[model samples]
Target: MELALIRHGQTDWNLDERVQGRTDIPLNETGREQARTAAELIRADGADWDLILSSPLQRARETAEIIAEATAVPFGGVVDGLIEQNFGEGEGMVVAEFYDRWPNRDFPGGEHDDELGARGVRTLDEIVGAHPSGTRVLAVSHGSLIRGTIARLMRTPYKQVPRLDNTSISLFAHDEDWRVVTIGGVSVAEAIPTTV
Candidate 1:
């Protein structure tokens, strides 16, 4: 099995550096181009994709649609499990401002960072397990979820995983064992950092 994990293209919140957890924002223009370019790169590499799984969010779905259109691949619509981690009341606020509001307090009800990481791992496990042998899945999701999934798969600390760029592709191949091909494409590799 092979998984192509892609982060959604840039959104307005991304450009503004706002906390966009659970927000259904659409992709910006640059994000569309990035998705297209990513699809082109995949096609150039001649990768045979067997399935397309995308987050329910508009941004990720939109990006996935574009990629599917470009590659002429059919998509398995909106899997809620692949959605971004919920930030509760911090949804739209700037990260710094959100921290200012919370100050020295922490959110309750398994709302901590660790809880989110665990949920992400569980979701990823379910998604990955659903595929059969030799199945290739293209998953379009948010940066945090993708990072969490990568960390879980690689057996690294969640906090240690590198930030994923918009529309970046992280490949994981499974046969007897799992392998992370390139964190992102060669060009994106230079622009972004990888955990391992």
Candidate 2:
């Protein structure tokens, strides 16, 4: 199985560097353009995607719809597990301020990092299991979820996973196990250290 993971387009919260975790923000005009660009890039890659899936959040769902229209691929509906991690008290706060106030990066009542990572893995497993052996799927999700998923798949520390840009693409392949191919268009061997 092969999968392409894409971060949803930018929202106003993203522009202001505010935490948008589970806030249900919509995409800005620029974000819609970014989604179109992502579709063009995928078309240029010459891969015929079987289908596209996305988180239930408006930003991600809209992005997936745009990509599906542009690529002529079917939209496979929302996967709840693809939802962004809840930031709890950190939602709507400027990212820098939130980190400054909570240096340890823990937000009160927020979802734990381990839980997010596990969810990421489980979601991918479910997707793969539901499809045929050679299925190629495109999934639109949040930055943190994508990062956590990649970290868990690579068996690397979450902090070591590089941040993903809005609409950035990462590819993964599965045989007996999952492995990262490229992240944000950079090859894993070039951009990530596989071992701790």
Candidate 3:
């Protein structure tokens, strides 16, 4: 089975560097354009997908819709479990603002990194197990969630994982074991290069 994972395009909140966990923010004009650019790239790849899964967040949903339309995949759907990590009281707060507000604070519900990774691992296991072998799936989600999933698959510490750029494409597949064929390649930024 081959799974293609993509992080949603930039939102206004993303550009502002806000902690958008569970905020359900919609895409801005540039974000929409990024999605279109992503669609064009995927179409050019000429690969067929059997399933498409997206996080329930509006930004992710919008990206998935564009992929489904461009790829003509009929099995596009939302999976709430794939939602971004809930930032609790940090939602919509800028990163600096969050640190300032809770200089010594802990995550709400007392959740730690391990707890979050466990949940992400379980969700990914279910997503992979539900589909048959050789099924090609496209999953649209948030950066942290995708990073956590990749960390779990690699059996590595979450902190050691590489950051996935907005609209970055990752390809994972199962041979003798699950493997990440590609990582952190061709992001939304690269789609429209600007000389600055």
Q: Best candidate per lDDT, number?
A: 2
The per-prediction CA RMSD against the true structure, in angstroms, equals 3.4, 1.3, 5.5
**Segments of candidate 1 deviating more than 4 angstroms:** 96-111, 176-179, 186-196
Q: Which ten residues in a row have the lowest lDDT in candidate 3?
A: 187-196
Candidate 1 backbone collisions, by pair: none
Q: Rank the candidates by TM-score, best first.
A: 2, 3, 1
Models 1 onward score TM values of: 0.82, 0.96, 0.84
Instruction: Mark the 10 consecutive residues where model 1 has the least summed lDDT.
Output: 187-196
> On a 0 to 100 scale, what is the lDDT of residue 154 in model 2?
82
Worst 10 residues of 2 by lDDT: 187-196
Give candidate 3 regions above 4 Å deviation: 99-106, 175-177, 186-196
lDDT of 3 at 68: 81
The TM-score of predicted model 2 comes to 0.96
lDDT of 1: 0.76
User: Considering only N, C-alpha and C atoms within 3 Å, which residue pairs clash in candidate 2?
Assistant: none
lDDT of each: 0.76, 0.91, 0.76
lDDT of 2 by residue, 1-196 (tens): 9998899999999999999999999999999999999999988889889999999999999999999999998999999999998888998999999889977667898886777889998999999998898989999999989888888888777777888899999998999988888887788876685552
Per-residue lDDT over 77-118 for candidate 3, one digit per residue giving the tens place of the 0 to 100 score: 888777898778777789888768876435564334566667
